[model samples]
Target: MLGILVQLIISWLILRFIAKTSMDVLGYRINTTRLLLCVGLLLFTTMAALLAYALRWWFGERWGMNPSFSLLLLANGIWWNIKSVLFEELIFRGALFYLLIQWLGAKKALWLSAAAFGVYHWFSYEILGQPIPMLVIFLLTATAGLVYGYAYLKTATLYAPIAMHFAWNFTNNFLFSGGQIGKGIFVLLPTDTVQVGYIAFVLVQYLPLVLFFVGNYFLLKRFGKVYVGKQHQAPQL
Candidate 1:
């Protein structure tokens, strides 16, 4: 799509002209060992996300068969989720994140990414200016941004973050039909959907995110540091 193309061009321009580095610094390449690592993390994070949705059921909500479900729609939803995830990862964690690390060091850069990601979601998720949703969304997405940024930093590759992001979003949008995209593999009828008390809601909502964010943060920490693709010296700023 033209939008994605323009974003790619913008990222390249930032790397080429502003960062004074080539795309090589992005480390957007494949290595067998790291690819396997990525795949493993991909499965791990996907299960975490799926289990998070499953927690909704534990709190009394129920799903009905999606009336509009079909193979064509499922395929389309998967592709759409891919593009959406790719768009966010590129915007948040691609070239600009690397440039930030170059200019500000990893700690500050990661915070910037986290803050920007959280605020950006305020607009994208359309909870802008609302108190509760805004606060919650910012905290959730910002924490996610930290994990994502760290993944990119430690691996020196976008693939790690992309796989995790795509896995989580795909589970929400496709498997669980939890997104605004359409009826996914299943749907919750309003009549069947149960609204629980604040305590139950908090447990169901925040607990899974805890598993996801905490799972990723520590597991990746244990994965150790490395370059995922072809070894190259960091671009000297």
Candidate 2:
């Protein structure tokens, strides 16, 4: 937690220095529209995740809800997830991405930021000794990063991606109990057993995330300016 706070502060300072402006210039401020968008995306992603879990359960995976709920535990989980994800977005999609846009064009910036975000997870996943293939994990995280980057690019606000990131993490970590980091408030399946094949498990788990990414990509392309044209200017709050 201390590390995350330190990283966030450093990221804020670096962004301010690089952009020659306040944090608002990096889309840190909030507004009604962005808030609404955030909420909508949150709900959408949560529903999508639940749907995936349901499909898995239907396919013979056993699931059971926790018998008791603790408000304190839920609050702590929310804080932890939000804090961790916020620090990441501020670094990968906030500071690094802003600089990349200036150096490369927007189109290049998008993929570059996404790739960096994916690569950033290599160390953590390695330390965790994730059973999934490294290449597969990299591709999955990179794809998620693309979705997040696209969200930031289109909305020009951290709210969209932050909400999406939080939802993804909260759903997987808290609601579904399938996350690599953090124990969930509820357990979706019996922790004692693995019911699905590893490859099938990965597909079922990540399909919604991939769908959300592809869906957002199209939405941004059709409705938002995702490409960095010559006339494009840096985003402002």
Candidate 3:
């Protein structure tokens, strides 16, 4: 918790120094329209992920409620996930992203920010002893970062990407329980058995992410113009 606070402070300082603006310039303030858009994206992405899980279950994937599930634990998990994602988004998409865009242009900033995000996951995955290969992990996380980065760019607000990030992480951790390391509150596949195919696992794990990217792309196309060009300017809301 202290670490998260420090990270937030550092992020705010850097963004303030580099962007020459208040924290609100980084899309901290929210209006009704932005609120609705964020909520809609959150629900859409979460539902898409749940749909993928349901499909996997229909195909004989075993799912059981976590016997150890506690409401307190679930609440704590939700708070932790939010804090974790908030710190990440604030640093990667909030501070570093703004600086990179100013120095390297938006195109370069997008990929660089995503790459940085992917690279940073190496230490955590290693510590967790993840079964997936490092390169594969990097690719997967980088892809996710791209989606989040694009969402930030399109909406010109942190709320969209933050909502997407929280939904993706929370759903994977709490609802589906099939993250890269394959642990969750709700088990989608029995880890003890070797019967589950790799393809099936991939579909269950990554399909929603693909849908999120595509779905968000269309959403932005329909509504992004209103928020466009507001990212670098003073807070409008």
Q: Could you give candidate 3's per-residue lDDT for residues 37-125 as a string of tens digits?
A: 88988998888767776776666667787777778767877887888888889878887787776777666788888898888888766
- Per-model root-mean-square deviation over C-alphas: 3.9, 4.1, 4.6
Candidate ordering by lDDT (highest first): 1, 3, 2
Name the regions of candidate 3 deviating beyond 4 angstroms: 127-132, 179-185, 188-202, 226-237
Q: Residue 113 error for model 1, in Å? A: 0.9
What's the TM-score of every candidate structure?
0.88, 0.82, 0.82
User: What is the C-alpha lDDT profile of model 2 across 94-137, one tens digit per residue?
Assistant: 76677787678776888888788777888766734564666777
Winning candidate number (TM-score): 1
For candidate 3, give the lDDT. Answer: 0.74
**Candidate 1: misplaced stretches above 4 Å?**
189-199, 224-237
Q: Write the per-residue lDDT of candidate 1 for residues 194-213, one digit (tens) a residue.
A: 77889878877777788888
TM-score of 2: 0.82
How many steric clashes between backbone atoms does each model show? 0, 0, 1
- Candidate lDDT values, in order: 0.80, 0.72, 0.74
Among all candidates shown, the one with the greatest lDDT: 1
Candidate 1 is scored at a TM of: 0.88
Candidate 3 — which pairs collide?
177-184
Better of 1 and 3 by TM-score: 1
